[model samples]
Target: MSASTKPIGSARGPAGPLESRPVEDSGRRGLTDRVYEEIKALVMDHGIEPGARVGIESLARRLEVSPTPVREALARLESDGLVTKRSQAGYRATELLSVEGLVDLFDMRRLLEPRAAALAAVHATDEQLDHLETTVEGMRSHPVTGERYLVYRRFAALDQEFHDTLAAASGRPLLAQAVQRLHTHLHMFRLNTAPGDALTTVDEHDRVLRAVLRRNPDRAAEAMEQHLSGSWERHIAVMDGNPAKK
Candidate 1:
């Protein structure tokens, strides 16, 4: 049987689970979270490249944390699909994307996200619109700062946040939850991209914003879906997995 090459537009809005707001640990053992979140971010930040064998001792030193937390964090990362454990080596970063997998994912997007955008347009409030505008403008103004460099490591994350913001504006928790779960898999296909990819992304976001501001659900959803479709095609090249450019 042939495989489905859908973009999982099923992620139209963040339809599944809202990322739990960072939780506070009531007890001392919970402090390990410092190491947990830090190490997890480090990986997402590309402190570790996919398929790169990670040395636990070395990473602990880099993060200025003890081996215990670093090791513990890596365990969590493994569960998250952000890292892969090798039988011979301790762990390595997971591949950002495989062409075959992405084809199917995009196909799904073609199904879900456009509809989500339309719903968001109808439901989003004034505050959501203002926040969306601020996010886009911030990206434009700070196109190439040190923080921008930070973004390169986590473009997948920034990409998710941008989308999630709009989904949240829809004020539907289930919608955001579903989309967030979908993106967790989506991050796996990441390939390095030019700053232009991000800027163009922000521009498309602007279109969705403008459409939503007008409360035109169809236009907003189409604008958002078209924007992501164009993005996946244009930057699909980045996932070729060449040595990441510095």
Candidate 2:
């Protein structure tokens, strides 16, 4: 998940020296972010056996950057309930994200997203619809990258954009803000483990767009639920793939 990746469109200087400029520092935040996103993305993408301990130093060294940002990113992941720190294990990814956890997340999305879409149906601009449609389209051609086992990092970015649009289309500042938080957390899960289960997701998003555009609240809600349910079953299958040890 680490690269001394140059800023967008910037030519890589001699590979030996990792540049450290204030402007570069601003850009390094981008790397730091990529570091975080990549690791988390790997978690979802690779389905790293949950509860497997991951070493920050190892990851930092592997990514080819300073450990400071990696530390910061891991802490943030801890806050999100995705990664945890144990006394001896250092930081390990959570393997068994419970079925209860999955069902709860789906419930929240079901309750909130439909309302948001219904609002958006009336309030959304044609421009917003066009923008969302574009983002949805981008997901189709997206590619996977980052550390081992976890590749959902790319799709995670796409999912975030889509839900944010869904909220913005609603045009209710308060609701959008609230939904944004939930969506962020939801994206964390959906994106984290999306790689292995993407075909189901592609079909899912296709249906969502069709329904949302039609401005059918019931249909949009149903589509969202169906998509998430498929995801939950996939995760449950993943969980069963490594049945609980006695």
Candidate 3:
């Protein structure tokens, strides 16, 4: 009955028929993924407060499962930067970026994204441009209201796709890889803000797409700069106006 010695589902007694074993195995695998998703939802929805240590045994008991799946889920979350693990500290929700840290992050983004946009303007093929337009259309279709959480997720995906496509269209593989490594979209979602910024983001993306489509590198770069600057200010304002929002 102790936590450390608990079996996940061993109380089922003996294994079933050989054919049915795979179903059991599949179900077991599904449990781990389900646990992962539930934990992720807790983190993303701020159900578990930020910077709080996640107690594995407590979570397992709450979910009516063993600690193994919870541990597995925490491992995956750590990789996604939603959870942090220390030497002996186990896991805690990743803390919000400080205002100074946010500034530094935006500074790096400003240096690279504008250059990428300019290169994309010069080099993007017709096919790439079409893809970019499609991404923009998808973003525009998802207004930042109603189910704001779901809409925010969709908009974030389209936004990531839009930027990744643009970075790749720059015809520099390394540049694309570098941009992807930053994991900017994931971190932004972890900020857990209302969707007000999403509307402005769509407009900024439109401006960038327009400049790229027009083959104006200077204009593209300018638009990208404006977007980054505006985004930084918006985030800063949100963080400052409501210290408890994060």
Q: Write the per-residue lDDT of candidate 3 for residues 1-246, one digit (tens) a residue.
A: 432223322322232122132112246779888778666655664556578788899777666678898899999889777888988978888877777767777888887899999999999999999999999999888755532233366777788899889999999999988786676776766674447777788899999999999999999999999999888888777787877643
C-alpha-based local distance difference test score of model 2: 0.62
After superposition, the stretches of candidate 2 with alpha carbons farther than 4 Å from their true spots are 1-27, 41-64, 75-81, 84-95, 143-150, 183-197, 244-246
lDDT of 2 by residue, 26-115 (tens): 466787776776566445433333556667776666567678878888887786566789887688766444556556766776777777
Question: How far in Å is the alpha carbon of 95 misplaced in model 3?
Answer: 0.3
For model 2, what is the alpha-carbon lDDT of residue 143? Answer: 41
Worst 10 residues of 3 by lDDT: 16-25
Per-residue lDDT tens digits of candidate 1, residues 108-206?
Answer: 666666777888888887887787777777656555322222334344445666677777877778877666656632354234344556677778878
Candidate 2 local Cα displacement, residue 240, angstroms = 4.1
Q: Order the candidates by lDDT, highest first — what do you get?
A: 3, 2, 1
Off by over 4 Å in 1: 1-49, 75-80, 84-91, 144-158, 184-190, 239-246
- Higher-scoring candidate on TM-score, 2 or 3: 3
State the displacement of the C-alpha of residue 150, model 3, in Å, after optimal TM-score superposition: 4.1
Candidate with more favorable, higher lDDT: 1 or 3: 3
lDDT of each: 0.61, 0.62, 0.75
